[model samples]
Target: MGFKPSNKSLLLEEILDALGQLTESLSWEIGTTNLDNQTEFRALELLWWLDTSNYWTTLYDTINIGTSYSQETIQHFFWDLTHLISRYLGLEISHYTAHPEKVAEVFWPILTNHSEPIEIRTSALNMLMMSQPTVSRFLTLYWFMQAEPSQQMYNFYYTTINSMANSKYPCYDKYRKIAAQIVRFVQHKWHHWSTGNYLLDYEEPMRGYGGIVQAILMANQRTGFPSVLRLTLVRQVV
Candidate 1:
């Protein structure tokens, strides 16, 4: 006999069906009044997916291009749903206080705890990354500092710097500043080594170090220019 579907499987099918329908009709106005609970849940699921996809530019474009839906309304609804989901999963915002040190203290353990389900930990990590940018920057630099010096460490440092440099958000300035600080800290750590050699290693993966070179040229770039660097890197890679 063919296997019977479990209740969980049935619900998942329903959610997926709902998502397919919603994505097809982006021009439709979204509100709780029109959507039943199941459809709403599925939409939130899709939003969470987009949130973690690391394609901030795509997210911005998809939500703003004459979709006829209220961007603020959709954001508010998504945040509200995410908050509920986090609470249900026992990953409440209240659990991580505003104290920068305390926030990292709580979040890092949860993120690195291999015993927890990956989805839950990822959800928690993304939530922290998006909501607590400053703290996230601190954590990224702090961890990099503590980590062993290696090619992988250098790659991560570049990745973070590049992302901050090319970010399109209004707070890209802040992100660039953070990236600059991290870069300086790293430079100081290896001050005895040749900066030129480090830049060569940085441009190795990208086949050229245009952005890295530019960052070096602009004295003010040290304060906040990784976002620009990241943007340049992405353009060149693309």
Candidate 2:
């Protein structure tokens, strides 16, 4: 009378379906839904089990349901599930010392997938960037820079580069190269705004420029590329 692996897999699938149904039955509001604490706890419990049991591949498949499900319920459930998983990863990533690379492998697609909600993507990005291992953080930043750029990509790039500039992350030399590439990309995208006039048309343009300038100066210090910042300043002065 032993509990078989097949039985365990079936039970896991049933649990997931039950959770999905519970999510569907709830109101389809993003922030305004009155979800119970018990539901969140149950989801977290399941995530913990999946991680500890080496079922992360299964969990990855579940989260990446893709855009095929036209039902609003399924879409919202997956979004909520992704957010919960990101939280769980942030809190429990240290426990994954033996398989940090695996964690990255599972979540990188979710982070880079434009179809995913920005909040979910941001959560995944933050979790990976803040993981205890420097390699995970570095790889996360590297992979993100290589991904297709979006309007929000500038903010992410600036934030990551700024953080690396200010921290003693032990990989500054490597990050310096990445930061240089980011500066070039940002410059190319927003070069039209160099005069600071076009930036005035957007909300919080000063804050955005301030971040870019900070990143430029930091990059200058590391790579002796003061001309980039000087060129930016010159453009502003002209």
**Runs of candidate 1 exceeding 4 Å displacement:** 1-106, 117-123, 135-141, 144-161, 184-238
Candidate 1 residue lDDT tens string, 47-80: 3343223334333444444234434333433333
Q: Report the lDDT tens digits of candidate 2 across residue range 1-238.
A: 1123345566577556556645555644535444543464565465455434545445445544422342444335544554354454433344433465655654566776777654455445544554433644665466555654653434444454545444333323465554444444443242211111111111234553221221222122223222222111111210
**What local lDDT score does residue 129 receive in model 1, on the 0 to 100 scale?**
46
For all predicted structures, in order, the TM-scores are 0.29, 0.42
Clashing pairs in 2: none
What C-alpha lDDT do the candidate models reach, one value each?
0.40, 0.44
Q: For residue 192, what is the lDDT in candidate 1?
A: 16
Once model 1 is optimally superposed onto the true structure by TM-score, how far is the C-alpha of residue 84 displaced, in angstroms?
10
Each prediction's number of clashing residue pairs: 6, 0
Per-candidate Cα RMSD to the true structure, in Å, reads: 17.1, 14.5
- Which candidate number maximizes TM-score? 2
